[model samples]
Target: MLRFEGKVALVTAGAQGIGEAVARRIAAEGGSVVVTDLQEDRIKALAAELGDALAVRLDVTVRDEVDAAVAAAVERFGRLDVLVNNAGGCIVSTVPEDTSDSEWHRQLDLTLVGAARCIQASLPHLVQTRGNVVTISSVNGLAAFGNLEYAAAKAGQIAMTQNFAARYGGMGVRFNVVAPGTINTPNWDNQPDTLEKFKALYPLGRVGRPEDIAAAVAFLASDDASWITGHTLPVEGGVLTGPGLLDLTPTGPFRKDY
Candidate 1:
């Protein structure tokens, strides 16, 4: 249970959703956590909720903010052992033609480049403690998502993880990625059809829970995964195994769509 005992972790966008879940998991497993978010109020609230963890206001897209967040973590915890780059999201619709250049940049900033920036800011401290990095990318990173910009950005994060793992393994800083599929988060509140649609493709017959991804992240951050690096683990409930791109074919009476 105390897999992360004595470890200090920083989870970006940790105020809510997947990020929040990750922070809580780390704390539960005996790690001291620093929860960072752009929403100062929520960050403070979550920090209070996490008891011993620190709450930091950070906009991952801003280099200074990223640096400050990492500094705060190291300052409070005395050392940094894990960095969870979980703050990125699709800020706009994936309709490529309609997505403006700014939107594209924003998507990449929040999802891909944001992780890179956080990594850069934390690398020094990570190297000092032989820490690990767990980036929350998307299954779209490997497959095609019409949300071309988001997909591209997530893909970039995966590439960054692989390269960082290769370069930093020597420094005792390992890097790995966890790609979740159709997670049931606040973001999905806007998509009424997402659950029904996702269940059809997800072999597990349900949308993923934040805790599911969090468990995988904690393992990768723990010594159990010390030998694992440059790996992209899809916590997708078997969705990645088959042609999940298309919905299941309806049978007999269920063929209403047909």
Candidate 2:
């Protein structure tokens, strides 16, 4: 189970939720973690709790912060073995009809471009260590869910991951994407009933948990998936099956009908 015995990983948005789960999982597997999040106190506490971890205050949307986080990872851990792009979330407020260009840019900037920045900063260190990247995308990227701009950016993440895999595979590095379905995280705290309602849409009879995603990410980032790259693994609870009337469209529950 110590798949990351001698490895090191940098996880963005590692304060809580899925990012926290990923950090905990990697640490549990004996990996050194560079836990970066906007919440300084939270990440610092998490780093202390993980024993062999470093906490960094990183705003993925900021290039300087991203670069500094990568540099800090190499400085502390001596090398960077994995980069987990887990900083993105749905931030759009306007409906598709009135969504502004600025909002679109903001969404793409955070979700898509932010990940690219981390990859760019980590590539050199990863090249030396033959490491890899695992981006946390969403099922909306692969299907017709809602969150128009978010979905588009997530889809762009997948496209970029594939391209990077192709471009870097020969250099002893790999790239992959993990598209998750509805997971019970703090992001759903505002709408407690939403997860309950969405559970029926899944064939597994329950929504996903952060641990579910952590398991998938651990596999993809570990040596177990050394031959796997340019791949998008959906960690949904069978929601993608679309059983019966469970159609995820603009009018579906998956959509934020703002």
> Which number leads on TM-score?
2
Name the weakest run of 10 consecutive residues (lDDT summed) in model 2. 242-251
Candidate 2's displacement at residue 111, Å, is: 0.3
Best model per lDDT? 2
lDDT of 1 by residue, 1-258 (tens): 999889899999888889989999999999899999988898898888878899999988899999998988888889999999998877675446788888988888788888999999999999999999999998878875445677789899999999999999998999999999878887768765756666776778887999999999999999999999999999988877855655434331112211
Predicted candidate 2, C-alpha RMSD: 1.2
Question: lDDT per residue, candidate 2, 5-60, as tens digits?
Answer: 99999999999999999999999999999999999999999999999999999999
What lDDT is reached at residue 135 by model 1?
Answer: 98
